[model samples]
Target chain A: MKKHNYSAGPCILPQEVFEKSAQAILNFNNSGLSILEISHRSKDFVAVMDEARALALELLGLEGKGYQALFLHGGASLEFLMIPYNLMKVEGKAAYLDTGTWANSAIKEAKHFGETVVVASSKAENYNHIPKGYVVPSDADYFHCTSNNTIFGTQMKEFPSLEIPMVCDMSSDIFSRTLDFSKFDLIYAGAQKNMGPAGTTLVVVKEEILGKSGRNIPNMLDYVQHIEKESMYNTPAVFPVYASLLTLQWLKNLGGIAAIEKVNEAKANLLYTEIDRNPLFKGAAVAEFRSNMNATFLLNDETHAPIFDKLWKEAGISGLPGHRSVGGYRASMYNALPLESVQVLVDVMKELESKI
Target chain B: MKKHNYSAGPCILPQEVFEKSAQAILNFNNSGLSILEISHRSKDFVAVMDEARALALELLGLEGKGYQALFLHGGASLEFLMIPYNLMKVEGKAAYLDTGTWANSAIKEAKHFGETVVVASSKAENYNHIPKGYVVPSDADYFHCTSNNTIFGTQMKEFPSLEIPMVCDMSSDIFSRTLDFSKFDLIYAGAQKNMGPAGTTLVVVKEEILGKSGRNIPNMLDYVQHIEKESMYNTPAVFPVYASLLTLQWLKNLGGIAAIEKVNEAKANLLYTEIDRNPLFKGAAVAEFRSNMNATFLLNDETHAPIFDKLWKEAGISGLPGHRSVGGYRASMYNALPLESVQVLVDVMKELESKI
Candidate 1:
């Protein structure tokens, strides 16, 4: 079966990235050492690290703008705590916009280190839309927000330009679109979604934003330490970083983020159009806030649920089942997800509607 | 040229493990989805997690005991801080045996959380031997030790049976030998040497030893939270864990820890015997404390340095250059390293001696 993977994370990657990564695993850069076994400090792997870091910055359009990119382990979840530990002051407060689960998780960790002010939240309506027009405090140490909500399929299209430093978790939607990279003091993403594999995290931080927290941050959690060491403070997630390098190279060869943004918008539109036109389905997030990366939807009637699921499964659609919390279907159309895959899902939806 | 990987780690892996891992990366379990793309929540990855956890405990002979095995990210460096964050109490003290660089790193982190006492150390001799006959303070929160020092090429041949909790960093020597598993409260190893890759860390913690720190441990660093969540407290290092599963399976098929220990010893002896016989080279660590996993040595004559380096490189030997801190050569022979590779190193050493 030709699987069209819609997994929110640990999700789809370009076929080229997969092929290259597999080849590297067998014999990394013809070094006769498996990528899985070669030392991170070795010339071949170091080149991978250097290239991955540079590409992450270059793709974000933040090259040489006093930003440093680090590829580290423990995923974006660790970043939730690390961002607060390294940025949130001991006695000061940081502002957060809670869009969904991941944003709230970041808030929960920030609260442990210092005071946290939830400037805005869409949680009241089960996070069906991105919260808007929230007052970010000028006095807060930093303002943090999640750019995309994976479960609810709501994305923050326009970021607020705040007086305080801006931090964002771009985990699910990073590289799916072009963004104003200069506005964020720090941007973190787990590589699983649009980047590469599930091990490494991409952290791009503006250099000046660190060393002001005044707390004794653990060396592992300190962004300054990691930045200074070029993400080799500890043995990094080498395989994932190498794989990420390949994916970033793929993204570059496919004409970078600008090119992918068009493809992403088209993929999202194809699925969203089917949901809107079909009588059996309803889009989950509000139209304005609908994510270009993740298009979540639901069956209009409970009776159609089983048939809808079976039809998609038979059509080789995987990971479309929405999170248990949301209780529907989520078609995550990341950057690498071709329009044809979304078309297949639309065809499945149309086929199910004909039965109805 | 065929490569002999003696990398301190990310190091050598079984060729079968590499082949299987590379195959899975391309098409996991014939599911038509790249392993890099499949959801970690999928049945395929879930089975991987389950089998990996089981195999780690089974190999350590801790199965069905109070020990809970967790595969996490951030390597042993993260464990340095996480160990203290979870085990060290605010007002209490922890006893440490400062064997080498990593042990000192762990001690450095522990001091931030609580009072840490270096019960014994061999820093005077540049960590060339493991400290002996040190009394562990009973009132300390825990007694921490490193089972193997990768940089210094020293291993703890004996562990103290202490009344207080025992925590060990077995980053370099894990799964290379059998041990009295119940003696330690926690055993953490970065899975680069003798395991799989440079990302995932294997943590086996006694269940009762947790939740006693009385500190607000970050969710990411809390072992209790990770154990409760079955190591999926967050998106784990999925690819590395999958690779580790294959390596563990390889170890089990080759008769587990006991079987590997004999092979490890033979490989160590083969290299050490050459270092002893070849007057051109001298062993770095004291004979009594020399690590069977990492055999550190130096050229008896500085004039032979360039020639010796060239000889090993030409023989396809990699990662034998000793750490800058301990200037010499380090031949790290992990579990997957065959005697043939060590023999090749021995041959290179002998050839270098003949030139002299």
Candidate 2:
């Protein structure tokens, strides 16, 4: 059976990345040693680290600048706390955009270290669109926002040009498109989406924003410690980093994010068009705020739900269920998720239409 | 040339474990799909999660017990801060032994939250041995100790029996030997040594010790939160956890930790005997408190150091350099390291001896 994967966070990965990373796992560069068995401080693995960091900088277009691209431990959830710990001073206030689950969680953690002001929030409308007209407080430390809402299926097409520095949680839609690097002071993403496996967290930070916050940050939770050590403070998740390296190489080979962005747009257009035009399916969010990465929708009737689920299962499709917070369907189209998979999903929708 | 990995952590893994994990990286279970491409919430991947947790409990002999084992996202480095955050209450103190770098760091983080007493310390002798306690503090919230010192190469042969609760940072030497679970209220280890890779931290905590800290613990850093969600509160390090699952399976097939302990003992004995008897090499730590996993030593003649390094590198042995604090050589003979590798190191020592 032809299988298509549509999971949200720990979604899909490219084939070449998997093949090469697997080979490295068994015998790294035919070095007669598994990649897992090598020391992180060794010259060979150091090269891997150097190249991965270099590529991340190149991809983000932050090279030759004072910014450091680091691969750190802990996922985006940990970053939810570390971001506030490193940025939010004791007496200062930080501006935040409360979009959905992850955004609100980051806000909650930020409240522990400093006062937080919701500059903008889509919560009033149940997070159906990217909330606009946020007033960035002049007295705030910085402004925080999530680039894409993974569960809510809303994206900020144009970032707010705030007077304060911008900090972004790009965990879901980091490498899917290109952006002006000069706008944001900091950006972070967990590796499960648009990167590689589920271990590493990539952080790209402008050096100027740190050390200003008057919080006594713990060493492990501090960004400056990782910045100084080049992210080798402790033993990192080597395999996941290596897998991410392979994924980056593949991305570069595909002509970088600009190239992939076109394909991604086409995929999103195909699926969203089918959902909007078809009677059996309706788009979940407002038309202006639909996510190019996650196309969410609801079936016309609940009676077709069971048969729809069975047909997809029979066809060997997986992770089509919506998040528990919202009971509908979400087809997550990460970078590694081939357009053919989206086509397969479009075909399923068409087939269902024919049956009716 | 065959490589012999003697890295203390992120060290040798079972050859089959590497192969199986590598296969999953490429085409998981021959599914024509990479494990990285799947959803962590999918049924197949959930089985991997459930089985890994199940096997962890089973391996620790805690399967149906009231205790719970969680796979945390950060390395054991995070536990340095998390331990204090989760345990230290207002007016409460935790007693800790200052043994080595990791132990001191744990103490450092603990002090930030509440009172911490360094009840015993081996710093007087430069961490050559674990400290012998004159007393365990009566009012301690918990007595914390590192089970093994990776840099100093010292293992605790026996833990102090205290009326107060006890927790251990068993980072380097977990699963390398048999542990009496009844004495511990909590145990945590980074999964880089004697397990799998270096992304996930395994935490086994007693339910009674939690919810008493009185600190506003962030959800990501909270052990209770992870326990409640079965470690799926966020997307975990899927590849590392999955790789670790295969390692536990390999351990079970080899008759669990007891069977591997014998092999580990034999390997350690062979290498330590070489260090003791050889005129060129001298053991640094006390013989009685030496670790079976990492045997730290130095050259009898400092002049012969360059030659010693060259010889070992020529022999394709890596990670033999001892820690800078204890400058010499450390041949870490982990559970997966074959006795044949130990013999090969012995042969190198003999060859060096003949030339000198």
Candidate 3:
């Protein structure tokens, strides 16, 4: 049976990416050598690295801009350390919004570098909604926020206009919706979500805002060093970058983020509509701040859990369970997840109501 | 034609690893889902992570010896930074042996942390030989060295006993030959060489050596944190780790390092013997320190370069060009490289001699 996979991350990618990447693994570009065995410096793999970096910038609509895209090895969690190591100055502060787990983790790492200020936090409410009306101090070296919270299924619909360089962790929602991508000085996402697989992180940084930290940075941690090397400052995650390029190419063929956003909206609406209409279910997050990429909801009565679980499992659904913090269900409909898969989950939800 | 790949790091892996990893990408474990799409936290992938970590220690013969193996990101270059952050105290110094490009790179990163002492260096000799008889300060935080220098084709044939933690960057020669695996307190290698691909790095550390640096280490750069998290401290490079696991399994099936070492010695002897006998060709690195993994050689008379290059290319040999600094040919016979490939290269060299 074809599974309706809704894994939050390392999640569903386009089927074509799987087939093509697998083929490359067997024999890359008809080179008679597996992609796994080829030197990253080979003309073939260098072309792959170049195209992947370019395609990522192109998909985000940042082409020809000062923003440079890098496919680095460590995931977004490493970016948490690099961001501070590259941006925060000696005794200088950085402002961060505590939205959820990832956002809070970023803050914890930043504190080790210098003064880290949490401008606002939705944590007190169990991160059920986006915190509003918070002030980001103008003196901050950078303002950081998580664009979407995967664990809580909450996303920031509006970003604050900040004088400082704005950095956002778009790990779960990048390339899902069309936004003013140029507004932020730095944006990063782990490839495991909407981009590709789990080996690389996509970092798009505005070159001008860097090298002002006035602190001596390690070569690997410095953005300038990576940018100068064209993301090949060291050995890159070649397979993941190639797979990400394939995903980005798939998105481009699907008319880019603009076209995909419409389908995503439809999927989110269908699941949220079912959640609201059925008395057996209720949405986990506040409606206004709910993430289109991941819809978190719960059964109104605990007793319906067994039937709902069985129905989804029998329906060939996988990865529909929510995070432990929000004990319910999370239907992650990433870029590659078909609308038909969302329909199947809704049907399962409705069937439970009828049986009751 | 099946080209014999001799590219250095990100070089050839076992053919079975390529096939199995490719299949996993399409559909993992008969689970009706791509390995690229499944959650790292999922039962299947977690098992992969567990087995990969266990297998690394098992292959190194470090199992049950207080060593914790971790698969990390950012390659050995990142370890250049992390080692200083985790092992070098704020006021203390560390000792390093500068052998070649990579060893010098390690020294540069360590200097950023604290006082870095070069115990020995062959840079003056263009790194054609490994430095020996260097004294390591007992008061230093740790003693660092590159076990094998890929760029210069030199390797440390012997290691000195140190009271301090002994850290070695075995990125190129790991698992290719058997050594006293318990000698080093920490061993790190980028998976691109003998292990797997370019995305993940394998770190094996003795538990007692960590957590004594006393610096406020960033969570990502801290080895103790990674060990505690069992290498899933963040989203690990899943594909690279899986592919590495496949390569390690292949090694074990072939009777592990003990069995592979005999083959490696045989392969090295075959090529080096030919280089010494052939009047037209001369070995680049010193015979005593020449690496078994990578053998650098040059044409004795530059006039025959085109013919020799053409001969190798015609024989379905690729990645035979030595690094620019060396200006010759480097036949990297990593573990996955078949002896037949080396025989082909030797035949080509003999063919050049006959043609000349």
Candidate 3: where are CA atoms >4 Å away?
A: none
Q: Model 3, range A1-356, lDDT digits (tens) per residue? A: 87999999989999999999999999889989898888888899899889888988888899988999999878999999999989998879999999999999999999999999999998889999999999999999999999999999999999998789999999999999999999999999999999999999999999999999988898999999999998999999999999999999999999999999999999999999999999999999999999999899999999889999999999999999999999899999899999999999999988998999
**Residue lDDT tens for model 2, B85-111:** 888777788899988888998988787
lDDT of 1 by residue, A1-356 (tens): 78888989889898988899899889877778889988888888888899999999999999989999999888898998998888888899999999999999899888888889999888889999988888988899999999999999999999998888999999998988988989999999999998989999999999998999898877888888898898899999999998899899999999999999999888887888889999888999999999998888888898888888899899888999998878889999998888999999999988987888
Model 2 spans > 4 angstroms off: A310-316
Q: Each candidate's TM vs. the true structure?
A: 0.99, 0.97, 0.99
Model 1 Cα lDDT, one tens digit per residue, B215-291 = 98778888988988988898888889998999999999999999999999899888888888888889999999999
Select the stronger candidate by TM-score from 1 and 2: 1
TM-score of chain B of each: 0.98, 0.97, 0.99
The docking category that best describes candidate 3 is: high
RMSD list, candidates in order:
1.0, 1.7, 0.7
Real interface contacts reproduced by model 2, as a fraction: 0.79
The DockQ of predicted model 3 stands at: 0.91
TM for candidate 2 is 0.97
**Which window of 10 residues has the lowest lDDT sum in candidate 2 chain B?**
B25-34
